[model samples]
Target: MKIAVPVVDDSLRMAGNAGHTPYFAIFNLNGGMFKTFALEGLRANPKVVVGEDHHDHDEHHTCDHDEGDVEHIKAHDTMAGTIEDCDYLVVKMACKNTAKSMSNVGVKLQKYNGIETSASKVLSELASQFK
Candidate 1:
């Protein structure tokens, strides 16, 4: 089985929040051996938008899309894609939306409070649970 853990850095320290984590440490467990890799590209914050003053020129903003017309990009989208073959996701905490999105993709969620713990240690403990 495989497990995915959200991490803040390449060292595999757990992130404070799951959805906001920038990277995921994926562990592929085979018998007693495991291989790990880091997946990046997830953003913890939204892009900042700068507003322009209309007094300087004639400015017009128009949109043809409604609220439902736009597809919201949830954290799970990227996470799910990264760990698509994984069986479970272990994280410190996950928001409702993120949890729901992960569930929709057929990935189970495991809650862990070991944010300061190393990924190798966490994976070892998780593997023990199955035995």
Candidate 2:
């Protein structure tokens, strides 16, 4: 089975739809140890942004949903895809909406928010439990 976690810079867990990386560590039940990382592509769905009218003076300022925004959306899409392939996702925190999306993909969401922990450490502890 595989477990996934969302983190920023390896430790900091992001809230809401902010930028974050999904750490997917795959485990080998037969060998009873970690096998490899299963997350290569996974991301969130697109967010519908309301742009200002063309007559607005700030129209040249660019809307929040620009090319950069598209890139961010792609990241989330990759995350969702990766989670869909996983058995479960251990998240410190996630947007309420995103959690629902995860659920729709048949990926269980496990929350770990009480104590500070790293993905590797958390995965190790979970692995020990399976033994």
Tell me each candidate's TM-score: 0.63, 0.48
Stretches of model 2 off by over 4 angstroms after superposition: 9-19, 22-78, 127-131
Best by TM-score: 1
**What digit string (tens of lDDT, one per residue) describes model 2 on residues 45-115?**
22322232212121123224434565655545555665576666765555544565577777777655435
The number of clashing residue pairs in each candidate reads 0, 10
Tens-place lDDT per residue, model 1, 1-131, is 66777666677777656665666677666664544333433323221111322121111222233335324444346556656666788866666656766877877888775534776677766665532
Top candidate when judged by lDDT against the true structure: 1
C-alpha lDDT of candidate 2 relative to the true structure = 0.46
- lDDT for 64 (candidate 2): 43
